[model samples]
Every structure is written in C-alpha cells, then in structure tokens.
Target: MLRISAEDDRDVAQFQQLHEDAKKNGFGRIFRSTFLFEDMVKSILLCNSTWEKTLAKMVESGKLNLEEMERRDMTAEQVSEKLKKLTGFGAFVTATVLMCIGYYHLLPSDIETLRIFRETLETTAQSFYDRFFPFQSLAYCELSQLDYKSVSGCSHIKQLKAA
Candidate 1:
C-alpha cells in the first residue's frame, strides 16, 4: 500500500499507471474517497434491514440528532436504546456502541481520531501482509509466464533482480 502512496520513484510511476488502470476498471472512486465516516445510526439500523429499506426510512424519519439527545440529557445508553427500537438494530449495535464508548469515549467526538487510527491500522496490516505473503509476486510471475510482460515491471520482481 506504501507503493500506492507514491513515495518511491518506481512507486510514483506504478501509482500513476494504477490510477489509469483503476479509471479503466471503473473504480477510481475507490482510491479517491479515502476518509469516509460510517453513519453509526444508519449502520445500526441497517444491521438486519435491506440497505434500500433503511435508507428510505432514514429519509422519511430524518437523521438522528446527537445534539438533541445531549440537550435532552440522554446518555449513551439512552441513545443506544433509541437506536435498538429501530428495526434491525440488536445486541450487536448496542454492544458496538458500548465498546466504542468504553474504548474511545463516544461517537462523533472520537470520529476523526478513529479515522486516523483506522487508517494507521490498515497501513500497518497491509505492510505485514505484504511481508508475509509472496502471493502478489507469484501471481506476477505467473502473469509474465502467460505473456503479460508488464508483470516484469512488478516492484517485487525489480527488487529481486536488483538483489
């Protein structure tokens, strides 16, 4: 994933090509939108319901207002209970809220920090996966063997030949 970060010269070239490839594959949005907030209330509600049904209900009912809850002196437990009243919300959603509150304080307030932390976790995990898994390199070699010569340009291939 560091290769996707455009740090190394080879990575810059590869990332550019990858950008083009992603555009060709109709997936440019996947790379473009990096930081996305999970709408906790919507996610909770959609737990068992179809996404379309959940969205329709949400549009009809309006968004959950955390500020209103706070103004009403409602605690996290109260808010979680309110969410569970919605169809599809269950023990999992309530448990998630309890866990998140315990670990990180609360929703909205911890969102930015959580986003950063999650990004860090993903990057770290990807690095570990890359180090442990030779699947990518092996796949590239197989592609080269199949006459897709661009597989020779794989970063692992270049690194291996340099060694």
Candidate 2:
C-alpha cells in the first residue's frame, strides 16, 4: 500500500487542503511496505474460513496473478470485477484490495462502517462520497481516525466514534 512514489505522495499531500476536516486533522499519506498479494491474503482471511487453502491453490494455479495486474495497471473497476468472481470476496474485501493498491477513490465500507456513519455521523455513504469525490476513501479514513470528542463542533459527521 505504501509504495515510495514521490508523485503519489505529492498528490495526497495536496489532497489535504481540499477538505476542512482533513486539513484540521493534518491528514497525510500512510505507507505500507507489504505487497499487494499479502494485503489480499490478509483481507481474504478475514472473510473466508477456508482462506489459506483456497488462496494457496488459487495463486499456485496462476488464477490470481499479482504481477499481471500490476503490469496492466488495471483500474480499480477492473481489479474489482476479477476479485468479485472469486470466493470469499464481497465488496468489502475487494475494496480493501483496491485500496491497498492505491485506489483511494473507492470507499470500503463494512456493516459496522455503515452503521457508524449512519448512526454516529448522521451521514449516508452517498453523502460521504459526494463530499469527498475522488478522495472519498482517504477523507473517510482520516475522519474515522479523529477523536470523537475533538470533532464535535464539525459539520455533519457528529458524535463521531473513535476507530
């Protein structure tokens, strides 16, 4: 997730100025050194009980090729479609993979994330997406990281929960 791309770093740095909450929170890029395949395996393990055996078999048989995906520089949509065809991959897992691969435009919301946004933030997923646009996931992540009490005076996303 944390590739050392100066270009990406610059873009994310500029993104901080776009949202008031993001600017207030000093949001910045978080790098992860783990490979995308490893991230996928970790995400898969969370949802699928037979994840170990299934993932091993899939990779060994060349069904899920990380190299090819990287080489193609496939869009998040393309990657998502391929992952959705596999077992144990719903929107959450697929979105996790896409995010790990640097696709911050997509929001990866599980049921809890949905509940918190609805109950705590008083905002729907649509509203979050609408506010943040291409950087929705990044903004969502930063907002989620804030202290609930600290953000009480902010617009919308009230009663935020610490996550």
Candidate 3:
C-alpha cells in the first residue's frame, strides 16, 4: 500500500528508498490494528510514555471487547470524543488514533515530533506539512532512523552556514 509512484518527485523517491533499505535491514513494518478500539487504546498509551510503559498500560488495562467497538462503527468524531474521556489522551493523541484509523490528512504533530523536524529539517511544522502533506508520516518514519550526531553534521547544516 505504501508504494512509491513513478510520478512522485524527489522527496517521495527518497522516502521510498529509505523504507526499502530499512525493510532489507529487517526493520519491522509500522504497526496497524485490525480492531479500532485496540488502536485507540494504543494511541493513548503512546502519548508521553515509553513503548515499555505503553505495553505495561495495555497489559494492566486487561481484555477489551474489540468486537463491540467494531460493531458500533463509530464515526471518527465519536471515537475522538471517547478517547478524550480517558486520562492522558490529549488532542494530539486523539488525532493520532484518528490518523492511524486511516485519516492521512492529519499530522499527529506533538511537541517532540515537532522538535525533531525543527532540529533535522530546520523547518516549521506547517511548512513541513505543506511540503510533505500526505507523506509526512512516511518522511518522519524515515528521518527517525538517522543518528542525532550525524544529522547535526549533515550537509544541509553546511549549506545553511554557507548561506
């Protein structure tokens, strides 16, 4: 589903290449959920917590009736409202779940992710979104693989200094 189109410009090509290389190196594919409720809860746990903490929270939360959530066939708005009721589920977390559930237009632009974009790409979130748009998440995933030191020393920094 995440294929690189022949018509896509240089940015998409870069992302596609990075994603392919990562796959070859045995990086696991991004996680998605068949059950909406599970994804909703996972998104909540992902907020302001480590992956270990997310797992621990899920385990502590116990069994959920994913079938019921599916059966409800709730609208994105409804699901967002429900997520808001949970502790620690903020606007960004709610947006993340919505995005995970196939709303590609929304960027789950939290503080940390924004900081990474600023540091690495040297761009504002709105500008980054304007350029990358639907592929922003894919770009973020690829960029996340870079070492901080290497990124800091990247040629872009040299170009910026020259300018």
Candidate 4:
C-alpha cells in the first residue's frame, strides 16, 4: 500500500498528459488507508448498504483473505472478482473498494456520478472519460471536486481547462 501513493508520480504525469491544466492546479489525494484491507473496509462502510456483518463474518472466519490483497500482486480485475464474490458486494461496492485501493480504471457510478457527469460533461452517456484510460476514476474524482468547489465560487470542471 505504501507504493500506491509513491507510484502516483506516474498518475500525475498522465494527469498532465491528459490536460495541461492539471499542471496548474495540483491534484489533491485523499488518504484512504495505509493498508488495502483497511481501505476496503472503510470504503465498504461508507459507500452504501449495511454489509458490515457479512464483511465482519468473512474476516472473522478467514473466508476473505483481505491481507493478501495488500501484497499488491493482484490486478484490479482480480480484486474486483474476489470482491464481487462477497455476498453483499454489488458493482458499486466492488468498484469503490478497488478505487480506494489505488485502482483508477473503474468508476463506481451512482446517482451522484450521473448528476455530475450530466451537468459537467453535459451528457448522460458512458465511457466519455475513456480518454483518461486507467486514470478515469481519478479524473471523475477531480471533476466532482470541481463541481463542489464551483458551488462555492470556484470554476466548474467544464471550465477547468481555462481556469
């Protein structure tokens, strides 16, 4: 998990490559956790539903090898599959956990994502963020940050390029 933020240098480089404005306004990273399992638990608790008992039982019974995920050997797809196998983990939960664990290729799209994308990108379409490739989730986070800040007088994400 330590390597996650250290390796973000590459993501930052891609951020610049995707948009020069990214270089002007530095990206803000919210610290999720020092361990992948910790992040999985935290994101799961915060995202939606009451899967706490299920997750707790799985952990207590050793049915879920959350620590092994910290090895960082597993691909995002691999982690997603394992998480999806969890009894209460739906698409959003799985994707949220992956994102919190430093996987940026997936989006945990929900109503908020839809509202922001529609207002900011002016589209109800999907895959419009494909240009960001594996960094799409981070890009979405940035867009949301912009939208919120704009409500308080900062520029919206759509105007971020010119900001």
Candidate 5:
C-alpha cells in the first residue's frame, strides 16, 4: 500500500522529472504516486487483495475521500487509524502501518511539506534475497542437461538471450 506522510519542502519539479525518467526507464509501476484520492484508495485496496478483486472493489466504491489525509495537522498515525475505520481495509494494512512506524518518526507534521519519500523497500528486499540466496547456475545446468526449458517454462530466460 502507498504509505504517504508529509515532509519538509524540496524540489517538486525535480521529483516530477525523476518520475518521468523512472517511467521511461520502466519503473513507472513502482513509482506511481499522484494526488488522486482514487489512486490512493486503489493502492490501499491492492494491499493484500488480488489485483482483480482490488480493481473491482475500487471501481465499485467509485470514490474514496482520503483528502483529509493531506491535511497539515494530520499525523500518519492518525491517518492510519482513520484508514482502518474504512470498510474494505483489513489487518494487512494495519501491519503495513506498523512496519512504517520507523519512517513515521521523521514524518512532517504538515501534509503538504513538498517532498515525497520514495522508499526503495521493494528493491531492497530483492537485493537482500539475492545476497542471501542468489540464482545458481547449477540449477540451470541440470535443467539444461535434461532439455527441460520448455517444460520448466524458461521463456523469460530465452527471451533475454534472444534480446
């Protein structure tokens, strides 16, 4: 889910430029943060639900008023509490907020502080996984010996090679 809190002022135009660059570089899906309440609610919906169910529920809800979230006086803790009151949310969202507690300490008291915290947790998770248990060529070597690329569904690796 998109956990946004206010922060100190910074270069918005630069952030937009970075966003555009990320989009061009195929990171758009990971960096999608617009001012739309629907998008934000959709982000919440997607927290634990399957993609189809989340989209369907958001479309069904039509509009979710989360603008109070951007209020200068609101705290992330308060916002998280209010969000839990909403109908569709569940424990997963609550857990996510708990996970975000460390970041909340530095949260801006104002919701319009002008800077977006683009945490790279997803990238960090992948890096951690790779560091601990990286992709091993031995697995691939055995698979290749068996000529089981088709059965094992290595289409992506094949595409990578062709490219």
Candidate 6:
C-alpha cells in the first residue's frame, strides 16, 4: 500500500487553514479533472479571446471528433499541434491543456487572473505565487470568489452601494 505523511510545518499549517476557511465559506474543493476535455477547450477558447468569441468557438469545437483525438494517444506537443489544426488554439491555450493533462505545474496565467490579483490582492503575480506556492490555484479560486463577492455585493447590495 502507498503511504503518505506530512510534517507539522508552517506550510502545511497554512494549507490546512486555507482549506478549512474555504470549506467554512461553503466553497467545495474544485476538481478540474471531472470535466477535463470541456475545461481544456474552455481554457483554450479564453486565450486572447472575448467571452462571446469563446462561447462561439466552444459551440463550433463541440461538433468536432474529439474522441478521435483521445484515441490517438499523442504526445503533449503533438496534441497541441492537432488541437491547433482543429481549432486554431494559441500557445497559451495549448499550454493550458498540457497543464490540465498533468504535464505542467503552473496554471495558465491570463488577463482575468491578472486582474483578480491586481484588484483583490494589490500585488504582483510573482508575490502571490511566492505566498501560495504550490496552492496558488486553490488560493486563486478562493480569493477570486471573495473578490467577486466583495465587488458585486453578493449580500447587502444596498449597503455596499451606499458605502
């Protein structure tokens, strides 16, 4: 049997706190793999593309033979090339898909994530990564929700507007 252990370190403690806080706020853990293909397509569509364009591309790509792509068992580079031929996906989008496929560590940094970091944390992406380290994506998800709630008045809209 495979065994795992964690030491009682500051990093571990911080991660536990973050996870608990997210759960307390009714934010369930995000398992991106459940909808891997769709997520990959959406991530690709989002690169240097408007929301409307992305939606349109999603509809268009939906008609393609995605299962065939899966059957080929291509390398990440080959998969990227094939996706580009099929959907005109850019390097960022290709990298995003590779990241999804467990080949990369970093999340695809995009304009929206950058905006969230700037508006919510008032800090650089590098600083955010340094603070969160391995849990950057999880931290981003939690903080992004908080940021949206703060700006959009998820509760007490009138009070927020008044202030």
Leading candidate by lDDT: 2
Question: How far is 119's C-alpha from truth in model 1 (Å)?
Answer: 31
The residue-by-residue lDDT of candidate 2 on 66-119, one tens digit each, is 866654478778888998888778888888877677676767888987777556
The positional error of residue 94 in candidate 5, measured at the CA in angstroms, is 5.3
Candidate 2 is scored at a TM of: 0.64
Residue 141 shift from truth in candidate 6, angstroms: 42
Instruction: Indicate which candidate wins on TM-score.
Output: 2
- Report the C-alpha displacement of residue 75, candidate 1, in angstroms: 0.6
In candidate 4, position 71 carries an lDDT of 57
Clash pairs detected, candidate 4 = none
| Residue 17 local lDDT, model 2 | 66
lDDT of 6 by residue, 1-163 (tens): 1111232233344545767865467442233545456766577556646554343454456754444444446566676666566443565676676555443434566677667655544333435445677887887688677874653422334333343
lDDT of 4 by residue, 1-163 (tens): 3334565677666757777776778653446677666666666675655765447787778887777765557888888888888766777778877766667677788677777766655431224456688987887788778864553222344444333
By lDDT: ranked, best first: 2, 4, 3, 6, 1, 5
Task: Give candidate 6 regions above 4 Å deviation.
Answer: 1-30, 48-72, 105-163
Tens-digit lDDT string for candidate 3 (1-163): 2312342334344545767865467442335676555676667666755554333354356543334434446766776676666566677887776655544335677888778866765553334445567887776667667633543433455443442
Q: Give all candidates' CA lDDT scores.
A: 0.46, 0.67, 0.56, 0.65, 0.42, 0.52
Name the lDDT value of residue 156 in candidate 5: 41
RMSD of candidate 1 to true structure, Å: 16.1
TM-score of each: 0.29, 0.64, 0.40, 0.61, 0.31, 0.35
Q: What tens-digit string does per-residue lDDT give for candidate 1 at 1-163?
A: 1113222344345445757764466432112111111334545553555665442455346565544443435666686677677565566655454433321223332355567766655554345346537685775455568955432333344333332
Positional deviation of residue 58's Cα in model 5 after best superposition, in angstroms: 12
Q: Tell me model 1's lDDT, rounded to 2 decimals.
A: 0.46
Candidate 4 vs. true structure, TM-score: 0.61
State the weakest 10-residue window (summed lDDT) of model 2. 154-163
Model 1 residue 62 distance off true place after TM-score fit, in angstroms: 3.3
